[model samples]
Target: MNESESHGHIPAPLGSVEPHAPLLSVPSDGQLLYKISSVENLLRSIVGNYLHFNRVDSYADFPGADPHDGRQLPKDQQGNSLARFEKSPDFSAANYYDQSRARTYACCFSLENSDFIWKNYANGSEKGKVGVVFEFGRLRTMLNQTLQPGNAALKYNGNQCDQIFSVNYGIVEYVDWDTHQANVDHLQNPIRYTYLKDKERFSEEKELRISLSAMGIGQFALKDGSMMQFPSSLQLAFDFKAAIADGAIQQILYASDSDSDFLQAELHKLRIVSSKG
Candidate 1:
């Protein structure tokens, strides 16, 4: 067939097809907003279609690990990575996201019954609020991340007893702070430190450290040397305060004594607990 006849149905290319590519390119400045909108629409549609979240009941196991290159850490004689710290399997997505970079990462499982929803609001001025719907993918990605040990974990001495110490530990969870009241009740008992098996667990000599993290916002290493991540549960005393701060979150304050600091007092308390531990 003649080129014109065979390709007749094909419209003539417009000045090198690449020239039209710009139309498909998303503007960097607007990309975030677009993503937010898309996520919101997807969430509404999913929620509207599904009467309940029963679809998310299944757990997706982690896929096989990729082969480690020469850059991978060396294993000890026992085949353990000396640098690796042992962790629990009900692995939290918050922990993983806390350690991982802000960039994209792999999910531990597919979100079958779960649906993710994100809400973005323009706060006064240039700042804005982002509300996120928790889902399996987000949860798993977060679990794979880690918290900066020095910041999130606090060790301090208590005023009541010289030997009394306090520790504040934080974990990630899909549930919000309000939902954690029940969980905290369960954790009131002494936590045995297997790592310090020789040390006895102390009950009276302590206060728990306060933990703070935004629900929708992912973790970030702050400029003042603090790391931020989602909290398993937030303290009740700071409920209103936390809601306000998280709503206006742009940058996380890492190490300031200002009332704006996320968990300064909590950290101090945690240290006290740790010393005892």
Candidate 2:
């Protein structure tokens, strides 16, 4: 909810409220809108589709592998330095052009489920409505190839370049603030981010910050200060059914501010009434 939406609803006075008060919900509001839930859902889908099995070995994970040597040593069949580190999963295809496979890092941004950053942004409490907070300790760097074109779709063939983690959905699903509805358009600039060679610059300092600009298109700056614009398209299909069927879903949550004890209380009340009869 935006500040406008938040301000529209004020909590009722204590005297006017009841423990089991029935609340009304907007079952069908036609106005096009977007919420933090959309982000959560999309992220969950990304994790299921790719993040869960990102097997690219980190230098730190390799015994005695110098962190500074991460840039070299790993080479593909051609002996050319690998563009990126990825696990060669037989089931997952690497480059769409070659029909080959390799390890691809599944980079993601995590905000603990309980974090109330969304609430602050919604209520206009965040100054820029732009800066974000990322836990560096939980950070993961992605393939440099992806940074070139965040949009993985092949320009001429309509093929998603990397089947393993390439996003298949189009821009039609993104929320367009101008129309205040969902809009679809090809990405002129694919949303992309790149981590600096010195990953420890921020972690050594023990600080993480996310930057956002929300007026027109929301842009999020990665911890490495790489800018990944909020996609003008929605690649994660909003179809929860398909997502679940394909195992592209991690968790589902339906949350509300209503009393958590309402259901149990109602059942108990019914039992008492029946006993009297």
Model 2: lDDT of residue 196: 17
Candidate 1 lDDT tens digits, 14-93: 11111112212112211111111222222233333211110011112213212211011121111221212234323232
- Cα TM-score of candidate 2: 0.21
Using Cα atoms with residue i matched to residue i, what is each candidate's TM-score against the true structure? 0.14, 0.21
Model 1 quality (TM-score): 0.14
Top-scoring candidate (lDDT): 2
Q: Please, what are the lDDT tens digits per residue for candidate 2 over residues 1-277?
A: 1123112233211111111112111112121111223323333443443222221223344233224211211212122212222332221111211211112222222234433433322232211121122222121111112222333322113323322222211111111212221112311111111111233322221111111111111122333445432221223223333333433333333234322244234434433111221
Off by over 4 Å in 2: 1-35, 38-111, 121-239, 258-277
CA lDDT of 31 in candidate 2? 18
True-vs-predicted CA distance for residue 201, candidate 1, Å: 36
